[model samples]
Target: MSIQVGDRVPEVTLKRLREGLETIDTYTLFDGRKVVLFAVPGAFTPTCSARHLPGYVEHFNDFRSRGIEVFCMAVNDPFVMQAWAKTQSVPDGLQMLSDGNGEFTRALGLEMDASSSGMGIRSRRFALYVEDGIVRASFIEEPGQFEVSSAEYVLEHLPG
Candidate 1:
């Protein structure tokens, strides 16, 4: 079953590109923190590059000033994630998490097979608002829809 608002984020080890291939434990990452985590099917795709990811990057300060840690996650490898960060000139505070094995994505019940599109197993675009590790709100997109998961929408729902 898909994880819902009351559910804690799943325990998983995801790789991230720091100065090296650093591992992040999801449980450790979210503990005692309010987090805004967004997932995209793949990096460098049109909608993701143009709007989804950019929306978060552009609003980084709004999230941080509210004391939320902003993370952009994808099933792609760390190298690609790092490249995307550089390409977009992502501000220093926002994080890019690489779920190369889709462990975290699958646990959230948000993984999808995009093999027909040559993208393999990927995440369905969605965003979550987690307060001290409990999901406060979830905005998931339907197939071919990008309405609710935008950063602007998530901002509106955050407990203020």
Candidate 2:
């Protein structure tokens, strides 16, 4: 089963390119934090580029003002994620993370097989609202669809 509300985020390391390639574990990233982690199937894809990431970027401050940290994750390498971040003009505080090996995605039962598209294994489109490492809400999109996982939907449905 995929991760559900009240589930603790799995322990796994995710890569982020900052001053250097940084390896951060899920615990360190999520513990004691209210985080909105939205994952895409790949970096630089059409829907993800035009709508998914940009929506979060446009609403970054709204989340932050609510004391929530936002993170964008994909099944691409750290280099590609960093490049995509720059191209998207992502805010400094909106983290771009790489689940290059799909470890975390699989651990959450959220990995999708995109081998038909030559993308190999990827994360399903989803947004997770986590508080202090426990999931408070989860919005998972259907394959080939983009609705529930959008930033606006997640923001509107965040638990009070």
Candidate 3:
């Protein structure tokens, strides 16, 4: 089943790049924080590289001012994620997480097959507002759409 509002995020290990090294299973990172977790199909894809990830990176301060930490995920290896992060002048507050093997994406029921495009299993475009590891809101895109997971959508959902 798709994860919904009020659902606790499954205790899944997420691969991330830190200090020039790959870090795995860092679930403790989200503990006691309000996180805006967004996922894209893959790293360095056109939409993901040019729009989706950059949108979050740009509005990271806005999210922090509202007491939310922004996290981005994709079904790429940590090295790719790290290189992608370097490609942009990413702000310090936004975190780039890699679901290298798609385990975390699969656990969230957010995995999708993109083999036709030469990208194996990947994550669907989606975003969630999580507080203390429980979902407060979720915005998942319809297939081939970017209407819901934009920065503006998350801003609109943020409390005043």
Best by lDDT: 2
Better of 1 and 3 by lDDT: 1
Q: For residues 137-156, could you state the per-residue lDDT of candidate 1 as single tens digits?
A: 89999987888899999898
lDDT of each: 0.91, 0.97, 0.84
| Local lDDT at 42 for model 3 | 84
Write one digit per residue (lDDT tens) for candidate 3, span 1-160. Answer: 8888888888777777676665655357667999999999987799988889888888888888888998889988888888888897777768888888888898889889999988899999999888888888899998789978998888887643
Q: How close is every model to the real structure, measured as TM-score? A: 0.97, 0.99, 0.94
After superposition, the stretches of candidate 1 with alpha carbons farther than 4 Å from their true spots are none
Error of 2 at 24 (Å): 0.6
> For model 2, how does the per-residue alpha-carbon lDDT over 1-160 read when each residue is reduced to its tens digit?
9999999999999999999999999999999999999999988999999999999999999999999999999999999999999999999999999999999999999999999999999999999999999999999999999999999999999999
How does candidate 2 score on lDDT? 0.97
At residue 47, give the lDDT of candidate 1. 94
Summing lDDT over every window of 10 consecutive residues in candidate 3, give the lowest-scoring window. Answer: 20-29
